[model samples]
Target: MKKIALLVLVLFCGTSNAQKKKKSTTNPIVAVIITKTENLTAEVIKPNFYIFRNENSIKKDTLLLKAFSSSITPTDCVIKKFVTKSTPLYYVSWTEKMNSETKLKKETIVVTNVQIWNPATKMQVFSNTQTSTNIKEQVFLDKNKTASETQERNRNEGYNFTLLPTGDFTLKNKAVESKYNLNTVTMKYELPQKSADVSKSSKKKKK
Candidate 1:
């Protein structure tokens, strides 16, 4: 009888623990790679962004600092970009798919793809892909929905900055906040190997 009671108590404890865990959600951590692609005209580069976060609401700006400290090579483009001396560049993507395709009403999936590029090298540096589905799809849905309440889909997407001191990272949603101060961020290039060449280029352009 004692053993039966203990077993029941243990089962109850386990079930309660599982319920508690389900109630809490982990925040998404991410790095957005904002870039000025060659195709991007001056007008489109407005309010570029790079933000990081953990599961909670806490913002993590340190990821940007760490990325600056990391060094990237040409080959590392598969995961992150480091070929250039300056500028944060990335891709944008947003789409949806049938979550469970069948004859009747089809479920859907939301997805986004983005590419990061370095203007100086004219090479893509990093790209990130993400998907959100299930009940969250309704929340992820675009605000501009149709009158029938079907989601009005838009392809607008944001990129994650992948450069890190270690060349690898998993952003936490609680660590970052959306960046809105683009004008304040210092955007400049490292000095070239020779000043004379710069002067010559300037003179030629003037002529």
Candidate 2:
């Protein structure tokens, strides 16, 4: 009888400990790339975008916007314009608002804006504004700690923008594209590089 009682207690403790363990979660960072192609023009153009944000608002809220051109060639005309003329081919902004008491319990309102221009001519080509709602859930392992996992639902309106080699922009949502020219616009999701990798690349470039 004594042996059986000890075994049951051990089993209960093991189950309770297993229940206390929390699973880990990850939040991924993604990037948007826009490319343009035209049937008449053989040259494929990939324009760079600049991002601007309200620092004060970001500090108070969970909003953030990060944009940069992937161009690394020093001799590229786009790089030259960016360095000497301080011109950006595109401008983008992102904003978000919570619609419920708990971040995980409710949907969020998201607004995205993009403005395109001719860098050389400095003429505005077109501007677009999109408003949509998304649901983001974050799970934490402990109180006041960072989330272990994060999941998003109905994000970005299920739209994927593609820039055909022919210099035309195609959006998965045709209705939105009909009103605006989405030329040379797309987005991508990727994991961030480690600091060590970044430093090594910088060192190689310097050498």
TM-score for each of the candidates: 0.25, 0.28
Error of 1 at 12 (Å): 93
lDDT of 1 by residue, 35-131 (tens): 3233331111112233232234444321221122122211112223333333454333323343554432345555544454444444444445555
Error of 2 at 9 (Å): 84
Instruction: Give lDDT tens digits, candidate 2, residues 66-171.
Output: 2323432112111111111233343322332435548545676655544344444445554444567777777677787764677677755534444334233444
User: How many pairs of residues collide in model 2?
Assistant: 9
The TM-score leader among the candidates is 2
lDDT of each: 0.38, 0.41
